[model samples]
Target chain A: MLDFSILINNLDTYLEGFKNTVLASIIALIGSFIIGVIVAVMRIAPIKPLNWIGSAYVEFIRNIPLLIIAFFFYIGLPSIGVTLSGFVAGTIALAIYTASFIAEAIRAGIQAVPKGQMEAARSSGLTYLQAMRIIILPQAIKIVIPPIGNQFINLVKNSAILGMIAGLDLMYFGDLVSSHTFVTFPVYIFVAMFYLVLTIPLSLGVGYLEKRLARSH
Target chain B: MFKSKTSKIAGVLLLSASMLLSACGKGDKETSGTAAKNALEQIKSKDKIVIGVKYDTRLFGLKNPSTGDVEGFDIDISKELAKDLLGDAKKVEFKEVTSKTRIPMLNNGDIDAIVATMTISEERKKEVDFSDVYFDAGQSLLVKKGSAIKGLEDLKKGTKVLAVKGSTSAINIRQKAPDTTVLEFENYTEAFTALKAGQGDALTTDDSILYGMADQDSNYELVGGTFTDEPYGIAVKKGNKELVDAINSALKKMKENGKYDEIHKKWIKSH
Candidate 1:
């Protein structure tokens, strides 16, 4: 039988872990979104070095495994006199790692927009930046919503990496509970439920946003 | 219409979640039957016993990357048990288990016994049966040789102590040094690596394990001797009395034949 007793006894531990996980996911989501947008613009901009830097950041980050990035922040940075707490390190790693994919999605969406939209705006006396912001971005965003939603959902789930570095997230407490009680299956199922509590709502919210945006257009 | 569709999707998710739970409940029943049988008979029937050993603890069952084999005190003892039972030292199959995984893995029938650097405790006794203490170990601290911190006493507020997850050292330190922050890693290697990377002020674990780490690197040394007695034992599934008795007898024979001392000197004293 699944041990409900382990769950009841360690509710505080689970809740603490749940709190940290939610905090890490939220911070990473916002951080990655900002970085992703900036890099997306830089990659598509008419500048040369900016395109190289943008391409380099995306290619370098998306290629490496997430654990290595998290480890770099957690265990690597201290040698250079940059010491970050586990939560800070893990969240920052999640942001930097996920931003690469988000930037890719945004860039693809921007490209999918007809070139005439940008050309037409620039011909009508709008600057390139203004055309992008006014005419191009709004349309690109609608096209990007589905893929961006996918990345955000992935971002939430990948926040579990925080647990590996003892960021005290839900997965970390799940490991603690399983080790403490020697009950592995039930503990992880409950941890999954906690993650679902965060992710399911997020997924549904994205679906709803996609639908609403489509209707408004 | 959209509201109805959204509700339907939510309904499907809820139904699937319940299905997963019930499926797991069914799995629990299938495994219980095998657990009721005596493990000793099962080992004899199989002709070889699978024992879980740590693949990370340096001198106690660490996997040598070059050789592709795990070697240590715990591994040697496991082989001796296999030889005593199955009449050949090679009759043992090794599985890697960490401090967090060893107990569940044993209970789940993944291994016949756990020969990892496991500390016997009353709480764990409720989950699994332990043979007599094979090795007497104690909890201690490892820090840089010139560290200002000396021992458990010096671990004050804001001190970050690194320990392996699910280990007694992690639990013990929380109780002993209530004010200090205990950061746990997945295994000893990560904890020790974190210590060297300055992630924590000290690393805490069994002195035997700390000795292995200290031996591997000259910069770190054990401090404050031992704070808590951690008697290592070979754990089997709970209620496996026959297997427990056989292990105890096998251990006694090893002690009497001077085989235990020989193995200890090779792994422990040589370091």
Candidate 2:
């Protein structure tokens, strides 16, 4: 049976989980975007060492599972005396892991801009940095919007990993409710609905922004 | 391209919607089917009993890495039950179950009975049937040696106690020590690992399980001798009265014959 009673009974628990999930996702989204941009720029920058570091970071993080990264922060870090709560560790791991993929998306976006645009900007008395700041990045942002939006959506769903580490996110509370009630199916169905509540708007916002960018161009 | 992307999104939406509707439909059919044949007859017809047990808890049913076998007091009891039912000790299959998954697995008929180190509580009795207590464990704390926390009274505000999610210990600690923060993990291994890594001040669970952890690593020892009694029982699906009765009789016979004491001595007393 489609049970609404489980959801109604555990409304406060679900809401607490919802709030933590939202907080974790927002913090991670902003953190990953900023880190992603910096790493993307470093990969494309003129300096050789910076490019190596950027590639190393992206390749290392992207290759390993996000769960291991989260575990490292949760269980591995405390051995050397750096202890972080589950929420803090899970959020940091989310940001760190997602940044690699976001970096790749941005790098591809930056490269998609025609080489002639950069040359033209530089030839017109704009410095390389100025040409990049004004012409290259703006165009790259437009190109990267869809992929970055995709990453953001993935990040929101992936925040469920926090639950495994006792981060008190939506999926964690979902487990709690299901375990307490032994009503497995409905609890997760409701949890999925909560995630959709965050992601559908994100998907629509991306579509809207894509359209607006196309119009401006 | 945009049109294709929109269509893909629409396809995903449709797929998820259908999945949600079909899941409920399937669940209804499964529950209805459970009414026809009880689990005892089904197990007898199959000739092999499937048991759910923990592959992580050391003194209970831990999977030995070198031997590639689950060896513990619980596994021995399950084997004896298999022998009693099908005339062969090996006529049983073990499916690993955690604190979170055992009840669901039992109710889903994935396993006929759960012999995991599961505590019997009134809340759980509504969903499943429990046999007489096979092991009398009590909730206790595991702290690193030489720590200031020696007992439950020492767990003041700002103290963090780690427990497995979906466990009675988690609920009990939250009630008994309301001021201390409780951190729950997916399983005992992770909780113990977290404690070793200094993530929590102490880890709380059944004293039997804590004994397993301490036996594994001498650095950690049991503190706070038993705050609550955790009577572990083999769980079967609710309404499976025949299966419950069969298990209860089997346990009674084991106790009468001293097989139960032998198992306890082998796994518990030695440690």
Candidate 3:
């Protein structure tokens, strides 16, 4: 039979792991949002070089596996005299990987906004930057809220990859505990529950926001 | 509308609760059957022995990437056992096993015996029976050649030690150096690679495995003689006294004939 006592006995270890997972997710979330906005702007920019750079970054990152990216930061970087703690390296990889998807989502959102909005603002003497800032981005963000929410949820789940690099995330500690105790099935059940604790609320919040946004529209 | 939303939440909660209940209900059922005849008698009739050994861990049982042949001290011992039993060393089959898979594979009869570099512990003895200790190993540390970290004592707050997940070394290091951060990789190779990449100050595992790493890379050296005594034993299914006795005698004969020394010298001494 599955024993809940192992979980109760080592509740502190699981909580510590959960804390790391949450921390990594929050940092990646904020960092990816900033990077995503910039890349989205660059993709929509009038300049040819900016658009190419933005497109290249999104395509290149989105194509590679998250594990490879995490390895590159965790293993590859140290060879070049750049050393980062596992937590830092994992956060950077997660943020960079998630940013690519966020950029694509925001780009789609930007395109969904009617072209007339941009033209109307430009005709009123707003600079291209001002027109994008004041007229286009706010509406584009609203259109992207659902997808952005989806990405955030994915980011939380994907953070499990950090466990591979010994980033001390929930999955890492779960593996350690399961192997030590040899209660593989229950340890994972507990891990899944911890992940659900983070994800279910985020999902519900997203649904609430989506409903509110839909009603306002 | 709010009532509908509340019902939806309740539905999800109910569904998850049922799933959890079902999972808990499906308790592990012990497989029972008529006591099979001794394993030695079965092996002789079948004309072969299936042994599970690690395909990683350099000196212990790593597979050569080029030839696909597993070569290590553990491999040699399994072959010796096969020769002693079946009159031919080649009458043995080697299956790859990791630390995590070894016990389940043995319990389920996926493999007849496990000759992997498995450490015998009191807790594990409940699940499986072990032959007399074939090799003595101990938990030790591997550090870069020029590292200032000398041993486990040097591991303090801010010191990062790399080890493989699910390994006793990982657990031992955590208890030994509670303040020191331990980062576990999936295997010794990965942990050693991390050490080379400057991810950790030292890598902790069995000295036998560490010797293998040091053999492969001149830049690393084994530091701090073994801290924990880790005896390697060949494990068979629990309560298999006949098989255990046969293995113990085979091991004794090998030692008496000086074959054990030769194999140990060939692998362990050279490194």
Candidate 4:
């Protein structure tokens, strides 16, 4: 029989890989969100050095392929005494690569909030920090939601790169299964379906959050 | 700096977040029950063996789409080992691994042995033990038909030679041709594809792989004399003397019985 019992028999391995893939995405998403916020603020800062740092970060990371960045963490870091496994390298690269886009989205979002709102907050005896915390960020986040959602989707797909360094993500296990079974099409289709299984609910959740936030507004 | 306080808050948040996010998602093996222990005893006691082989390599270890079996010389070797150990070759489990994986999988106890086209080198010997060289492979270059690169001798600075990640071929290229900049892919197919894409001057790997690539695409031809002596060996964990001894004995038995030659001919002739 040409049926694929190999994939069925290898469910545990595939599931283990799925766990890693989701773990990497979760880490990358949180990492990029925090990084984007900081960079967005720095990019819009009046200080020259901070602005330069922000610009340099965006340009330097955006220019490099995510896999090269992954290699930097996985292989290059070891020379300087910092060693990371493939999964860590993949996640870190995912975080750093996605951060550039996230920061752009966030900066635009922050700027989109009416300048009058910040001015009003300042006139009311609030410090700059107080105004941003109390009035600016909440509104900026609303404008930033859609673009950030796209980056989230991208991060999930990019998580597949972990297969290169054997990060044991879903794609890595899928490769293992497909290579063994020789049912490349069905095995990969299964992997795609699994990815859909993860992303569909995530997209729905993002949509619901957007709707709820709009209703509150 | 009208919003100095705001900037400070942002800076702190960004730094903390980068640090915090970087902290999650780094680990080694997360093995559960049915996990591997002391490498030597694990295989002999388990009643069967799991040998890791390559999936993407052609002739030597390819997934035959029609048969649904990982066909090639390496698969035959793995099955022979199973027969030697457990009395039935079909009882052994096959785990598909790439060059990047075969080692970690071995170290983590995910596999009992690795019989892929793994070359024995001093650096790798530090990590695992190798059986006697089963196949004597010489380095060769695969190039598009009538391409300028004649052989390894013609390789120059910035001459991208495609190789798989974690392969000694990359290091070998560096050592043999010091000035060449090597472009590594994840596996054999990508290296060959990159070669076709003109990403490199030549694809340098074992002649077997280069020949397989050539067979797939007539535009590409295998060039270059064998420069480095890459002897393929079955890898077992270092200090797993028992498994090593068992594997070596099995090889010896198969070779003496002429079964090794028969199996080798079975898989390699088509390449």
Candidate 5:
């Protein structure tokens, strides 16, 4: 059995870390999904400028490491007169970085859907937006959910970067507690379990949705 | 009947979860020395004083990697104070704190007092009370021991100074060398590492912390005298006169009885 007396003794501090991690992940998850969806759509848009803009965003963010993206947002943006809290910076950077991947996944899914779907919707008098919203998107969403879920799990793990800026997230707490307690292994194992507590369910939920979406398909 | 039982179970689970959440935060803040003493009384009236400390700082404090026990100068001071306050020095709890969150942790009643080589500054005084300067330190630069950089004045134009964000050193560097770029890192070790890795020409922080790094690596040394005074002090919550008085009295006694000097020599001078 794992010796957890130290963990039990310091459970309160770890819980604070857990709260910070969960909150940061949730915020990043929502923000990234929104950004991913928007950019994914733009990447396939008809207009030349819009397509280039989206392509640039996706490529630029996708190439950089998440930490660099975070620092860029945390430090770089401040130079241009925008300031953000560590949480916001971390969450936004996590979202934007992961969004590139999410956008790629979603774009792949949309492309996998037949051009016939868009064509059929257009022939039936639906606008491009309407076709994307009602017809093409539903199938694309189902196809992209699992990969997007993977990106989300990564996002949750990546939330730790916020601590570099003192975001007070779970990873920050972990770093703080472990450095203080000098028990990095057990502290991390506890944090890993906490992450599993959030992500395991997500994985299961994704698996379930993947199956159900397959069935409906 | 099933619904009632289910609801009862849910209620109990909720209570337990909340208990775990509050358990970590349940300790009361001691502003005046009395609250700290009362709280100490509440716990040590049962037996144990949990003192939050820093484990990253060398000479001042550090966690021994092998034993997983934090030990250093500040730790020794707290231990001695515990002996005076609780009648048994061993009945103490240690928590780690960083510069940014140390004050918040103290304010939130997480630890009784912070003995983390905290610098006494005017801005910090608004939130917490300080015992007299227990450790004399100031903002200074640490570089590779053989480096030619003598002091802040000697740095070439466009020199980079590594410092942690929100640190007084960062503000100090900007003031002293407005044209230089200051690369802010998260903590002491990173800044030091950055200096070693050639990310920056010099690392700036309290000399005590720099000494900690120096103790670990001979290649690096404090390059200049403290450019700004950064007197270290023991911190307690603002308005906690009881705990404050007990700590200050204990500190005064520690200094008078030569326990302070003995501790100083043992952790600092002996090294």
Candidate 6:
């Protein structure tokens, strides 16, 4: 029922797409995590303006569609003389969009930490920044591991949108192969399998990490 | 708890797999049932024909956003065919189709025909029968007016060529200029937008589509005379000789009666 020759002949194309997807997802993962951390810190900081900016950023980004943000970078940025390749534009958009949700998750984790913990750190002569870095964040991250993992998984799936702007990701190449071969169902099935190959391992790793983190606590 | 979670995940995976298998079975069943009567005869008895047309292509078959009506060269051609076949121009239903979905939709009997500025190609001919060329187009380049690239020859190594995904233009560009990097977007609009944004050096597609883009924005112009001949045709299901003959006759009538020229003037003249 399924033809394997198309898959066999076009292995390189599929691999190129898979490589782009992995590269984009990894970059966006690291980029969004960093942004999420910073935004989460700002949201919890004592400075009012910083807190407002953080809150506004989260609200604005989380509320709008990721595609719009991607289009803004892909189509809107070039008008201002800031042109980026599809991969870069899509990664940046994915990072920015995902950061908002990550910020909320991190913030929730931070808030879940006992107030006494912060007071205890300050009483021990640790600066607020030091307390956040050396004390609170590590524990907050540990507590929020599952949610963050879920976000990471979502980030991988959302990366499919990169196909829209011609990022050369898996879905994009899958579309190309399917259209060229006119074997839509099987081509997509293979594409889905490739995605599962990326995501299932990540999902399992997250579950393992969650279990380990829970045991440590 | 870990065991339970693993089992749950496995259960969900199993369920989805079964669902997909069932869907494939259904698709096979649907595609197997060919109507014994010719499509033209069926359409005549039904008194309505379904045409799959592009809702995104601008001059060819774009849907008017404000009016919620599809209008363009392809739509006009479909209407004219309807008039010739059924004696009523309005006796046709329009279904939106993209390049990717048009063939599958036609094969599945979801649409009686495809009049979506589809290029007649040997590869596509194996899947569906096509009417005689209703519109003559060719592959061309759209670039910023002052760009260094003059034509297809300038599309050398490292030259970024943007084309729509699943389009023959992308394949043709690669064959014509193998060294040029081809980026395929979901549609011409996205590809054109990316060209304006400096995403690629040139946008390659049918000259008719490039004309539409050039018409929309004066800054971009068709850089090359058509590099590849792309004759557009109305497609029907493969082996539907009766339907193919009916469409070919209708097209011949349209040309003889000057209706074809009227449509060409309406959509292609300004471009």
Q: Tens-digit lDDT track for model 3 on B1-271?
A: 9999999999999999999887655522212221456666777877899999988888779999999999999999999999998999999999988877888888876678999888998878888999999999999999988888988889999998998877788889989999998888877667877899899999998999999989989999998898999999999998888889999999999999999999999899964
Worst 10 residues of 1 chain A by lDDT: A176-185
lDDT of 5 by residue, B217-265 (tens): 8888888688888888888867766677788888899999999999888
Of the candidates shown, which would achieve the greatest TM-score relative to the real structure? 6
DockQ metric for all predictions:
0.48, 0.59, 0.60, 0.04, 0.07, 0.61
Give the better candidate number (4 or 5) by lDDT.
4
Clashing pairs in 3: none
Displacement of the residue B99 alpha carbon in candidate 3, Å: 2.2
Pitting candidate 2 against candidate 3, the one with the higher lDDT is 2
lDDT of 1 at A174: 90
Candidate 1 chain B has its poorest 10 consecutive residues by lDDT at B29-38
Per-residue lDDT of candidate 6, residues A1-217 (tens digit): 8888888988999999999999999999999999998999899999999999999999999999999999999899989989988888999999999999999999999999998999999999999989988889788988898899989999999999999988889999998898767677889888999999999999999999999999999
- The residue-by-residue lDDT of candidate 3 on A37-91, one tens digit each, is 8998899999999999999999999999999999999889989989887788999
Q: Which stretches of candidate 6 lie over 4 Å from their true place?
A: B1-37
Model 6 vs. true fold: TM: 0.89
**Poorly placed runs, candidate 3 (over 4 Å):** B1-48
Give lDDT: candidate 3, residue B42: 73
Which regions of candidate 4 fall more than 4 Å away from where they truly are? A1-217, B1-41
TM-scores of the candidates are: 0.88, 0.89, 0.87, 0.54, 0.58, 0.89
lDDT of 1 by residue, B1-271 (tens): 9999999999999999999999988768646645656789888876999999999988898999999999999999999999999999999999999887787788787788999989999888888889999999999999999998998899999999999988999989999999998899999878887898888899999999999999889999999989999999999988888999999999999999999999999999954
* Predicted candidate 2 versus true structure: per-residue lDDT over A14-96, tens digit per residue: 99999999999999999999999999999999999999999999999999999999999999998888989899999999999
- What digit string (tens of lDDT, one per residue) describes model 4 on residues B1-271? 7599899999999999987766542213323323456655555566778889988887778887788899778888889988997888987888889887888888876787898999888877888899988888888888878877888778888676777766777667868888886656678865665455454678888887777777677888887678888999999878877778888999999999999999878766754
Q: Least lDDT summed over 10 consecutive residues: which range in candidate 2 chain B?
A: B29-38
**Ordered list by lDDT, greatest first:** 2, 1, 6, 3, 4, 5
Q: Which residue segments of model 2 deviate by more than 4 Å?
A: A1-9, A181-186, B1-37
DockQ for candidate 6:
0.61
Of 1 and 4, the candidate ranking higher by TM-score: 1
